[model samples]
Target: MFGPQVFLRLFVRINQDLWPWQVLAVVAAIGIPVLLFRQKRFERRLAVGLMAVAWAVSGYGFLVGYFGPINWPAVWFGWAFVAQGVLLAAAMFSGGVREAALPSGRFVALWLIVVCGLPWLAVAESGQWQALALFGIAPGTTAAAGALIVAVITGPWRWLYLPLLVLWSLFSAAMFWVLQAWWLLVAPMATLFLVGAGSWLSPRTAQSPD
Candidate 1:
């Protein structure tokens, strides 16, 4: 949907414009998951709800507002992100994630690493503080965060929806790589790794009586 030059510029520019959001996204990324691990009554709503906001903001704020000015297809992507946000928000009430397996200690750790690792990736790849692609502010981080959420939560559409997220993860990684954002490559890999790990471990956990 975008040329490499345009995509790179989009990442750099949006990050600069939304610098404060980096702190907020990092805070939410770390806090919300911990609450989810506790399996708090309202944690599910809060966690996924945070993710929905990320998606929507990335759609409207980044894609529609920023990227659209440079690339025409970004407007369509903006709407797609908005739609994805709605679906993600709706997932909170579907009883799917609620019924899905609770995260194992390892699963929780993996998820945390994926979320918390963003800054390192940003500094290493972009080599500029202002270009940090913080979650909710940039598309790649947003998609990775969303995939991480789906990985731990269980539901009827769990399998159905995961591939789409993973696909986005790949797409995001490719986009990052186009700009030589190497550390960002770990995003999709880490996400898919967790997804695979969760898939393998969950069945056994579910079948085990404990």
Candidate 2:
């Protein structure tokens, strides 16, 4: 009876020269968000499938010793934001789909400002303000926060969240060189796909008694 941790450790050892945490970080990033929001069984399965793919990719990277430690958590979360984008986009375009009410423009703007601003504050408090001067704040944190704010204000335009999730994933990948943030590459992609598929296949509208 082997567990994920046991397998993960084994993979790490085999990879030797490479950092295995990156792989784990990415998988967890994607897996956690999907698990958080997946309301349908089929969608859960799809998300799981995507995670499996991510794991396999990480394993391959590990075996080849092509690993490094970066801000993988930030990267993964960034992809989660992309998933949110996709969901929002879908909600906007799909005809049969019931669009959730958009958030007030003021609310969205205010939330976006907060989302973008808080990371700077966090870094400043940590004496990492100089780091921000160089790399800026982590985009994943800001994007994810903004998307969640939007979702909350909009009252669950679940379908519109996908693009944000994709954006998160892409951002994470782009930052791979900066922090070797591999999690950004894998996690959000898997989770967002799961959430998206679930949202897509769900009944168009909830029914009410006549």
Candidate 3:
């Protein structure tokens, strides 16, 4: 396994290589929750599509193309992310998902926190803004935010999108613990909170937007 220093360095390289896309990713991340909050069918569908793009890009672009060289397991994770993207794409058309309305503000607030706060945690840990783990590009934020998004929605397939994200949350949390990057645990904690909230909310929810 790679050490913290190498892991941090890997992030720096990823940020540099991804360049302006990082800016776009953050921008899109900020907008996604707002779109969801609108509760309009078109905007909600757009948000899901964007979420799919985030997963697919981070999967192949970050995991397979970059992180895979150092961590072999990430290659398989990359493929899994790609599969998740496909699943989400299918989910956009799911009957319950497409027509559902977002009736709660709590989930949106949590989603906003994960999407907005996660990238800066990398900057805080590494003391380099270049190391920022933007939402759409970075696996940590992507999975964390994506999990929160899926948790609040109503659909038979809603559960399908969550396993990989939950696994990634646990996996990344373990990685952070190993590195003693204690602060970065926020990413995983946020994800776990979503799982908990979903457990509580999914049962009560009849049909709601993700």
Candidate 4:
């Protein structure tokens, strides 16, 4: 495994190379939850579509194309990200949004913090603005947001998407631990908490109906 400096350098390079694309990542990251929060069918479909694009772009574009040369394992993760994109595509077309619900206020607020704060966390940890880890372009933020996205929607099929996101959360948490980026752990830990609570609440919410 690479050391913290190498990891930081990789992130720096990625941020620099990706350039203005991070803006799109932010837009997609924010747009997804915003659309889902609306809880309308067409909006939900658009959210899922954007989510699928995010996963695919993050996986293939970042992991395989950019990070893979540095870390061979990331190539596998890249493919898995594409697979997740496929799963989301299936969910969107197969009527998975039918029972989607507004996330609890706590979920919404936590997600807001995660999505809004994560990119800058890289800057705080590395002391370099170029180390920004934007959502859709970075695995940590993407998986974190993906977990929360799955949590807000109701259905067993959504569980298909959770494992990879949680796996990436745990995996990235380890990487952050190795880097002594303790604050970065918040992204993964929050993802776990929100997803667990969302899973517990979603079924009950489905049965009860507001």
Which numbered prediction scores highest in lDDT against the true structure? Answer: 3
Candidate 2 lDDT over 43-117, as tens digits, reads 433433333333333323422222223224433443443443345344334432323332234433433343344
* Candidate order, lDDT descending: 3, 4, 1, 2
Least well predicted 10-residue stretch by lDDT in candidate 4:
201-210
Question: What TM-score, computed on C-alpha atoms, does each candidate reach?
Answer: 0.77, 0.30, 0.87, 0.87
Q: Where does candidate 3 have its weakest 10-residue lDDT segment?
A: 95-104
lDDT of 1 by residue, 135-162 (tens): 7877666776666566545666566557
Clashing pairs in 4: none
Task: Give model 4's TM-score versus the native structure.
Answer: 0.87
Candidate 4 structure quality by residue, lDDT tens digits, 1-210: 676667666678887888877888878877876777674688878888898888898899878987788789889999999999888888888887545465357666766777778877777877888887777887777777777666545476777878887788788788788779887788788778767766654534435544
Clashes of 3: 1
Worst 10 residues of 2 by lDDT: 129-138
lDDT of 4 at 93: 85
**Whole-model lDDT per candidate:** 0.68, 0.37, 0.78, 0.77
Candidate 1 lDDT score relative to the true structure: 0.68
